[model samples]
Target: MKVIHLHQEEKKIIEEAVVQNRQAQHKLYVKYAPKMLSVCRQYIKDLQQAEDVMITAFMKVFVNLKYFEHKGSFEGWIRKIMIHECISYLRVKKEMKFVEDEEFTHEMHNNIESQFSVEAIQFLIDALPDGYKMVFNLYVIEGYKHHEIAEMLGISPGTSKSQLSRAREVLQTQINSLNKFNHGTI
Candidate 1:
């Protein structure tokens, strides 16, 4: 994979945007909007809603640009903002519910074949309940720990663990059913 290096002009654009330069800000937006929209879509099922969230996140990013310490990648900082906006949108729209940890005792099994495409895995995840989907995306896809997920979503770590466990079980069941259906055994 070829990495596209940001030229010095790109760095200057960010610096100028930090001071609220409109043209520089537009340049930054044009450069990052497509990638950021894709990130928002991972959390939001609706494309229009994802676009709204991405716009909101970009607004926050521009407003907070002055606070960026330049210690990390600018794209990373922007992506973090997009993720937070998605979580906030989910909280407001879906109102996450936590199942009791004790209720999740089933041992998880992976019935999904390795040959399945990424889209198939994503479709199974998208079928999960809101809470399960959020936890699964944060932990399995985004590499967040249970403690971090709990802090982000204002739930207990045990709740995060339970949701993730339930997500895996549900996904396995769905995959098994799909396999049976494909093989005409259903």
Candidate 2:
């Protein structure tokens, strides 16, 4: 097995990229674009828009490359940029509309657990509204707190909590529907 000195290699690449080396910048882009695009898509819901946001974020990454302090994982920094770009794009498009719905039925039916494929999961998430999707992705997937989500999306903590609850309610309903369909009960 070939041992890779990841710290030394990544440090060297980041150092080069910081100095405005085209190859190193290209390397960083190529390494993180796919994941960053997925992050963008989680918010934007349009493949073309996600790609555009990823490219835009990459440009910002390169422009602000000198500010990276190397105190954390480089990919985390890039992901934050992509996420911010996605939020900014959504804001400019006027697509993020949060509804204040506090009436939540926090219950699951049939007590049946079903394994979901990635495509099915994405489909379920894709079916959610923009506000719920954002909250759900941030709170559930990204492991952020309600207050953190609220601050990121410029809303109140209560709004973030409600959005997450609503997203879960919708997803649970969809899952139940899928389960019934799979069991030939639909």
Candidate 3:
């Protein structure tokens, strides 16, 4: 499955699939499942729930493929669907709570100085509380605005900003502790 080769012709295949080509549709699913699963996992936090969300999102994408105008990147469009589906799953779970800290600010400048390895940072992100993780992923990783995150997660923009601030603060603290512990060992 050379996606790069199909990138140019995917619109035609998708259009055909929209009309009636089960094989083309299946090919599209196979092509997108892994990436979509990753997207789903960021929001749901449970492997099974993520898989279920990916399946539901793919179904919606295929069913609604006719609405696609090829005006933008197909991958981006599908990614949006996965994001929406994950948010919908989260909403149904009613886990959209936000941390409130009036004094919290995005002042974790030390963590961004390239001192922490990618694996270390990723581990810290994975360990974040659910609310923080969701906000961080939406705002930082996915390039969404705090207002968009607020609407997606049903929280206020202040809450989204607060969660991101708290997440960064936690990551900074963890990194500092890790550095201190490592230094003491040396």
Give the Cα lDDT of each candidate. Answer: 0.84, 0.85, 0.83
List residue ranges in candidate 1 displaced over 4 A: 1-7, 106-112
Every candidate's CA RMSD: 2.8, 2.5, 3.2
- What is the TM-score (0 to 1) of candidate 1? 0.86
Q: What is the lDDT of candidate 3?
A: 0.83
TM-score of each: 0.86, 0.91, 0.84
Top-TM-score candidate index: 2
Q: What would the per-residue lDDT of candidate 2 be over residues 70-117, giving only the tens digit for each residue?
A: 898889988888888888998999989997655544433445476898
Which pairs clash in the backbone of model 2? Answer: none
Model 3 C-alpha lDDT per residue in residues 1-186, reported as the tens digit of each score? 688677668877898889869998998999889999888877776789899999999999989999999888888999999999887787788765676655557545563455677656766887888789889889888999989988877778888888998888887778778877878953
lDDT of 3 at 19: 87
The positional error of residue 48 in candidate 1, measured at the CA in angstroms, is 0.6
Alpha carbon deviation, residue 109, candidate 2 (Å): 12
User: Runs in model 3 with CA error above 4 Å?
Assistant: 1-7, 100-103, 111-123, 182-186
User: Which candidate, 1 or 3, would have the higher TM-score against the true structure?
Assistant: 1
Using TM-score as the yardstick, the better of models 1 and 2 is 2
